[model samples]
Target: MKKMLVLMLTLTMVLAISACGGKAKESTTESTQQPTTKTEEAAATEEEFLPEPGAKLVVWSSGTEKVLVDEAAKAFKEKYGIDVEFQEVGPDKSIERMTTDGPAGVGADVFLAVHDRIGSAVQSGIILPNDYHEEETKANNSDKAIEALTIDNILYGYPNSVETTAVFYNKDLVPEAPKTWDDVIKFAKTFNDPKKQKYAYMWENGNGYWNFGFLGGYGAYVFGKDGSDPSDIGLNNEGGVEAMKFYQSLKNTVLPLKTADITSDIKKSLFTEGKLAMNVSGPWDTISLKEAVKNLGVMEYPTLPNGQPMKPFSGVKAFLVNANTKYPNAAKLFANLITSEEFQIKDFELLGNLPSNKKAAENDKIKNDPFASVFLKQFENSVPMPKIQQMNAFWSVHEATFTSIWNDGVDPKVALDDMVKKMQDSIASSK
Candidate 1:
């Protein structure tokens, strides 16, 4: 822990030195301004936050909606005269790359990452806080987006979209979404035909993210209620073990393939072809699934066997400025711009993503959107993926553990205990 703190301090010093010139440049812009009215004062204020001289920026995002970035970049150039480039980078990999590529000055000026990874980014000191636009961001975006992007009291990301898993079903086959996992199982008994590549339900069954949907109760969680207490892992608790047993029971009754055979692509292909009835998926797949299947319907997660709403992981994808960027001001400007209500609306119109901005969510199109609305409802019951660096271990440990329990028929209690121990050790080593 001390070594981590030292690294954070060292990186902070480097960013501080690099950004010190920004205020001087702002002051230089301010001195030349002779403002006599509030309008001019506002204009000066906007102009005063200037980027470094001749600074250009590259932004990294998943590229599903590159057009959104392109539009934002166009407006950004109009305002700051800075050239902004959009680069394709998966949010998951982008979070990892910031650890190595960012400090080396080879990463994008601003990059998109899932909010859960904020802990790693902040602790590494490779990303700057959303200091300049924190107030605006908070007032515009949903509370969940704000909370997910914040650590301690500091906001670290410009909120873009919020997502959670939900059960998507073929309306033609099922008519209504399953009300509970039991409903899913009952339907599976009659609907499943492995020989015909058909099933009543499908999902990334063995994946930790999917299994996380089953864990919900007063005392069952990855770490603790807020997922912040590393010492109090609850994955081995009574509720968690029960959830795991039901999880395995579902697999035993429905799908006959090994865990590895249930790839996302295969599930998707089956679902689209009407070979599968219901599957748990997020909004990213909504568009293509709707396009491929005319009767596609999405609804918030069904109630679990434990009589609680399925608590899948909730994720917020937001943009963060690279602390090591040559153009901190420009990078921040782009992040702020793209996270605005209009930009978020564009994201929704183009990609069907749930806008984090409150006004964007209130847009007529989004409010009426069938698919987006269900995920929004699910977000209420969803678990906010922990924003601690130790969550990395949770993923590594549980991914294999869940698969082992499901595929190898390992005892749920024993598997969970071993998984918790491994996760604890990984977190301790990192500390």
Candidate 2:
């Protein structure tokens, strides 16, 4: 199965550390020598880290971020005398698409992806570890970002940004953001109107991404040991069942609607129209929400019913080097260069993303911006989504399990236990 999957994902990956490597190592010899030739100078600087001579690389970038990639490509070409081609591929779809494209030799040499999907990329054997720049990467970026991109101890990503959801409320309806889930519940008493399609609070109900906060606050995790142990599932544990019970209870009292009826579009429309009082959304919604509502406020999420800090999953976006690339050295260099402090800041300025670079995160613009500030604070308590292949299956199971409990009256424990079993079955079958 492993071999078949690799064949499905990529044809061959030749990344010889001896052939094309990383930074110049610290020389211990006392004698000093001068490099005479251009090749010698390049080797002495990178020492073994030089890119393949005349190497050109292809980079897969999202259409929205193509300009940034173009900038990086231009800078790289000027510095190394190698050209780079920019190809449009949605960052979210890079991993799956590479599975077929990579083997055919048309895939990117470098690509951008969210940290959560690193495991699938690794298991498919289509990407190279960030072996060349690991040390400096850790020193320059946030530890959590580094941790998120590492799968089973291998550094697979060059960190770019940190993202997580936070509280967004209408200042007219909510004088102050709710400090607890109970606070949201209390406000619902006077605010809910089933016929008018108005509600005090609303979120994507069945979506595991948002709902995971409750499970986390109640002390349940998806898989044990930071998602490395597939055998130790935690969704059916005591905390998980309790979390779902509270999640189930909120159905009628707070929202007064079925999970399917509360789509994100409807919620956004209601919030903008001044009907919905509050919402749990990410930073991406900042501009749109601000345009519609005069008094929109953003803040860290309120504590859960159990009094635990909201643990929404923090997602780190990263640049990954493809293993199938002909020029591993050039690919790694390009990946590292694009995620440097300069580019990170540019990404923030142009895209409104929160940079993973420590210095970039400390910039006054991000610190002073209310919406960006909230997500940065919330990231302190947030957990990265599991970096395991099972997560690909876990999302569907989570949605199914939560939907059944919220809509069908299924018992939380029974539903969760079934969820665990389904996860195990899926993991086993995938193997």
Full-model lDDT for every candidate: 0.86, 0.85
Clashing pairs in 1: none
Model 2 clashing residue pairs (backbone): none
Candidate 2 overall lDDT versus native: 0.85
- Give per-residue CA lDDT, model 1, range 1-431, as digits (tens): 99999999999999998788888898889877768786787677887787888999999988686888999999988987888888999898898998899989899999999988899899999999999878778989889889999998999999999998888889999987788778877888899898898998878877887778877632478867787888888989998888888778877776767788898899898888889998778888887888898988988777876677777888999999999999998888889999899999888888888999999998988988888888888888788899988899988877789888888989999999999899988988887
Model 2, residue 200: distance off in Å is 2.0
Backbone clashes, each candidate: 0, 0
By how many angstroms RMSD does model 1 differ from the true structure? 14.2
Per-residue lDDT of model 2, residues 126-205, tens digit only: 89999878887998999999999987788999998888988789999999888888888889998998788788988888
**The best candidate in terms of TM-score:** 1
Off by over 4 Å in 1: 1-44, 217-219
Model 2 misses residue 285 by how many Å? 2.6
TM-score of 1: 0.89
* Each prediction's TM-score versus the true structure: 0.89, 0.85
